[model samples]
Target: MSQVVLITGASSGIGKSIAEFLVTKGFTVYGTSRNPKQQEVNGVHFLALDVTKPETIATAMEQVLEKEARVDVLINNAGKGITGPLEEIPEEELRSIFETNYFGPLRVIKAVLPTMRKQGSGLIINVTSIAGYMGLPYRSAYSATKGALGLTTEALRMELKEFNIKLTNVAPGDFATNIAAGRYHAPLKQDSPYAANYGKSLALMDEHVDHGEDPQKMGEAVFAIINEKEPAVHYKVGAYMQKISVFLKGVLPSKVYERLLLNHYKL
Candidate 1:
């Protein structure tokens, strides 16, 4: 029997690519979106899901389980980007970003755990960004959200070990995706305090993303992770420089690493 895979935010970009690729690999794939009514892909099934809402999530999980009976793989790929000076970000907007980026995936995991435990095995893949490891200059909130998820995922991995369920964090450096399209920008003008620096940092971020790795490549990386009997807790998928930056952040002195990051962003 083929494994049943459930991927969130699969209507477009990396999520869509992963769902479509897995379908070709013989997994029964169920892809979710806030509005999946027209998210029809040749080999992927669409399910309506709004990760921000508890009711929508519960309803969507029910719909999937009701149809598939068992879901073996769950990929939490739904996220939005928020970029700007942390000082300028509204409190509510920061909270909202956390709602979708950090807590959203956890809610879905909670809904699926009972069934996964009963089944004796399951796999969870949380898609996080490399910026989470080394904070980005103008994207502090976005970085914070991903960092929170990464830490939470680590704890969950340890807790779920004896239960036969496995979880891993897939940290992508920069992937050509629609993530930048939905980015939240801080309100600022030429005379505003943070405008100049924020604009420069934001522009560099945009350039980095525009030249980032391919979204389709993530499908192969994730596919390999799923097939591993014992996968690492953290996996980095991006350009060699980006991956090296993450490594150097751990090895270099705090001030040295800070200087390096600032220089990279031309700050």
Candidate 2:
């Protein structure tokens, strides 16, 4: 039987590409976004889902179950980027980021667990970032959310092992995605002490993202993971990211890593 995969944030970028790739590989692909009209892809079914909304998640899952009766893979890829100094970020904005990045996946996992448990096999892939493993200037809020996701994936992997559910976390470095161009925003409060530094950080981030890896590569990596009989717990995509991971593991100390990041971003 063709495996069924549901991917969130499929309107664009990595998620959209992943959906397209899966369909090409003979899998039943269901792509989700906040607005179904926003999805222009033809082969996959686009479902309306707002990860931050509980009712929306529940309803989408019900509809998927009704049609397919089983979901073999769940890709938690719906997320936004928040760039700015940690202190300059408002509490509300931080909460909002976590809502979409962290709790959003949790909600979807909860909704899908029952079905996966009943089936005795499933794979959950969380699209995190290299930022989740190491901190970078001006991305504390964003990185923290991914950090939470990393930990969540670890715990879920252990707890769900007996049930034959595989959990994998994909940590892509910078990717050329609409995330950098379309939805990124600094926190609303204008009076923070780190405002100047925040501005500088955003400028640097913009420059880096412009030259980042292709989103399609990320999609290919995700497809490979989903098709694997034994998936790894963590994967680092992107050329620069793989090198950085090696450096972090072999040479850089925590303090040295912090200094390197700060100097790179001029923070």
Candidate topping lDDT: 1
Candidate 2, run of 10 with poorest lDDT: 241-250
Output the TM-score of candidate 1: 0.97
Candidate 1 per-residue lDDT over residues 1-267, each given as its tens digit = 999999999988889889999998999999998987674687898888888999988988888888888879999999989988888789999999999998999999998888798889999999998889977788889899999999999999999999889999999988888778888888657877888888888888888788878888899999999999987899999899989988898889999999988887777
Deviation (Å) of 207 in candidate 2 = 1.4
lDDT of each: 0.89, 0.85
Model 1 regions more than 4 Å off: none
Measured against the true structure, the TM-scores of the candidates, in listed sequence, are: 0.97, 0.93
Off by over 4 Å in 2: 38-40, 187-196, 241-251
In the predicted model 1, the residue pairs found to clash are none
Q: Which clashing pairs does model 2 show? A: none
